[model samples]
Target: MGEWDLRRLRVLRAVDECGTVTGAAERLRLSPSAVSQQVSALARQLGAPMLEPYGRRVRLTPAARLVLRHAELVFGQLERAEAELAGYLHGEAGEVRVGAFATAIAGLLVPAIARLRESAPRLAVRVVEAEAAGAYGLLAAGEVDLALSLAVQPGGGDPRFVQSVLLSDPLDVALPPGHPLAGAPGLRLADLAAEPWIYGAAGPWREITLAACADAGFVPERAHTAADWTAILAMVGAGLGVALVPRLASARRGGGAVVRALPADLPTRRVVAAVRTGTQGTPPLRRVLDALAEVAATVQPD
Candidate 1:
């Protein structure tokens, strides 16, 4: 054991990786002689030869390799520490960008942000409206710190992200004001099997709707296809077709459409928040996630 200086250890690692003093100097933005001197001092401190010549390049001695291995671990831990410190400093006074679908933006994201403004005034929340898949992409690409999506299993089990289920948003049936099922307290999805259907864009929602309908022994006649819940509801209100709507998305009924809950086991999508694995430790991100959960809890699932 000896007094190990990180600076010297870095110099040794650089020289080992670069294969020459000049190469190490260039990488470290130092003169070649300076790099040599640092390595020399490190050799003296550790009481062991740290480098060996191999042709025109340099190689790490057995002892130097051991030291460098440990040095890498130390450097990594230090980097993580710095990141945590930065997170703490910025948690209450920094900006966090979020990606979410339109309905989440309306029913959960916006309200969560408003709550953040009141509680953490210095923390600014930026939002981008995107669907679940797109939002998850943004999160993976580092374009956003957090994403609100219906895809609870984001990253498909990729270890790079942490997914938290914020809530289970249930799917409801949208009916026109004078429709036969408009006033029903609880309706079986099978009962509407014969009705014209306005389905969402082809994706998870459509899959759930189709699966539920299939379980009910019928296939909905796709009369309209719209991505936006409001648009879907409008189509329903015009008596064009009935559609399945997520409760969070239908916070405000449009086009004179009435929302009716389906049977308990029908269909529901999990509202999940996906973040870079280590970002959940950031104070600001944690605050925003908490606020989202709080707001989501207040939503009365139809």
Candidate 2:
């Protein structure tokens, strides 16, 4: 046996489908003799009988039937590959894995996904909820194409990645309903200093909470620790403690918690997108970045 010829296999499958050399040739726009010759070459290459004569036409031998079955799969896969390639070339489709914090996934990525589906229906986006540092780790490890992180990740001069500021997410205070500071017209971080705090899971957000409190001249008294904004808000609602929630995370403040803005000069986390240095120019990635920017634009930064 020699190397398999895809052309010969195609011809063999065509013959099996059409049930005759003449019919296969008509479908393939080749002479019946050429079709018969292709099938003979295929049989010779495989060292097996391809077709057996029937009453008037010809039928595929068991060996040929097996080859045709596999050939059909090959052809189908090639067709799919071609379609996907076309999508990549047009910037309308491809898989983009995004690693982002939970807050950004809800406020930014979720909205961007809706737009992407409408604008590039064939594009596929896989999102992973990760903290700032973890998201950057995944980006560096090649597990994710884009990472949405806070300034705490600090990719400033890293040669391995290109970090672009996506937005500035302001921190807000989540107080229990009817708490002393809830009635105040203008809230300052200092006002909540004496109250017990429900801090977020250890990461950039928790760091932000601590730093904000330190700037306000007191350390927060922690009564609860949670990774989820909802859980933190619920604890605050129960009067367990107050919490520092990002604007994006507390947009729909409820569960008996009242959200208040910090002073204009107070701290806000710089949300950013990080991609491999050379990947920013990729068509699909470019589209995803553009969509993220569009979504971020809608947020009113403090």
Candidate 3:
């Protein structure tokens, strides 16, 4: 048989639905002769009779019934494809991969994903836990659609990525419960100058801790080194030393420690979302970015 035209298949299905050439033509707003001509053309193309005389009207032949059954499935699939395409065009569907640090995975990305479940249920999000430094590499390599990272120096960020600030997460001091300044009010980073500090041995958190301390005029005496927030908090709780904890991680401060707010001049780390320079405007990427911002707005420092 020659190639089947979808328009002819549609006309055949309409005839089956309406039960007569006149009725199908009236339903389709075409004249009865045009309807008969299309059906006759389709029959010739398929080398089979599609209609037969049945009393004063017409009935489908066996071949026409089989064609209509398969045509129904084809039409259903076409509708589904169109719907999916519409969703992709509107930023409501498709997959988005994101690279974020551990704290961001918990504090921002997870919440943003939850919000997307309600707002864009068909949009799939895949997450990679990566630090600020590595996330940029992932973004550059196109391994991720978005990257949640700590803000780099002013005018020092990569030109290949577009960055947007998500939130400013304050850094608070986690002190052992028995420490002299455990619950101190009006606390300042300078007050902890002489205290032993527990911090990440490397990564952006280490840089943030060291930089904030330097701005306060004293280098913190390193008492322990740990990259995991839970481990650092555990060490602080065990009286191993105080640690600078970002508000983003404060919620996980397990036990035996007191998290205290610093003076109004409290130090903070800027959290940002990054995407490939020009691709930030992409549908799925933009939807994920907007969701992150919405979730970030609800994150308050305790």
Candidate 4:
């Protein structure tokens, strides 16, 4: 409690585990007397004895046991804090933690990463491929600095945080290559109303898709209740059924499926960037976000 060195906590825990001053000192690489002195100093600081005699070895006093439990937890957390801070200060091109949803990774984040590699060769951009709905959560908790997420309309997520709408890419229906709609000029959601579909209801995208269908006048016949667009499209490629997907689905090098635009009416989904509420827009994060925006701009809506 008196701003004692962390070593005092370690000495206490080691002695508790090893059950002897000599053994604890050996584990900590300190002399037995030093361990004794440190423990005694800690006891004096706390105004209580932290150890109890037990046969040839020593056991913890009730107070030592209680404090040691908390000490272990505190030390573990402190170690993590130290490592994260180390990564933060790590050289000129330190690691930047980023989190994004899966489709975003395939959509624009991969290109963003490539652009960052080309422009800032030294910056280590650490990416975590997490669910899009969870991306903002990661940013909120300080687990990540930036998040790439999706919303039906721009500026809808975390108004208290900074959001940059990168692209308003159109969503399209992906069908098997030889399917009847493959060569069609365009489609309306009602055009495929009778067709069984596959989708994930884990996020707003699910509700957005379903609500869009309702507005079109028919509830979708869910052929598959699944997550992960790759698997969803794989099911589509198998001709199992068709599903709605974003434009990036076309970026794949053919042979998978055909993406056809929705008829002139349906709203487009806005893909955006969400940075912490007040990042001060440092040059490093600014440069990274700019590179991200540049990548998003290149994503032509098919």
- For model 3, the stretches where C-alpha displacement exceeds 4 angstroms are 1-3, 153-156, 183-185
User: Against the true structure, whose TM-score is highest?
Assistant: 3
TM-score of each: 0.66, 0.73, 0.86, 0.63
In model 3, the worst 10-residue window by lDDT is 152-161
What order do candidates take by TM-score, descending?
3, 2, 1, 4
Clashes of each: 0, 0, 0, 0
Clashing pairs in 3: none
**Candidate 4, residues 210-245: lDDT per residue as tens digits?**
877787888888888777677777888888888888
What is the C-alpha lDDT profile of model 2 across 192-267, one tens digit per residue? 7788888765788888888888888888988778877778888889888898878877666778998888875466
Q: Which residue pairs collide, candidate 1?
A: none
RMSD after CA superposition, every candidate: 12.5, 4.5, 2.8, 11.6
Per-residue lDDT tens digits for candidate 1, residues 1-302, read 56778898888989988999999999999999999999999988888999999998889999989989999999999998786667557666578999988888988889988998787787889999887768878888989999887763436487998888888888888887798778766678888888989987666677777877887789889988887777888888888888888877665679988888887556787888889988888888888999999997899464
The best-first sequence of candidates by lDDT reads 3, 2, 1, 4
Clashing pairs in 2: none
Better of 2 and 4 by TM-score: 2
Candidate 3 CA-lDDT value: 0.87
Which one wins by TM-score: 1 or 2?
2
User: For residues 1-302, what per-residue lDDT tens digits would candidate 3 score against the true structure?
Assistant: 87778888888888888889989999889999999999999899888999999888788999999988998999999999999989988899999999999999999999999999999999999999987778888887889888888885331366787889999999888999889887667788898899999987777888899999999999999989898888988888898999888899876888678888876657999998888888878888889999999889899554
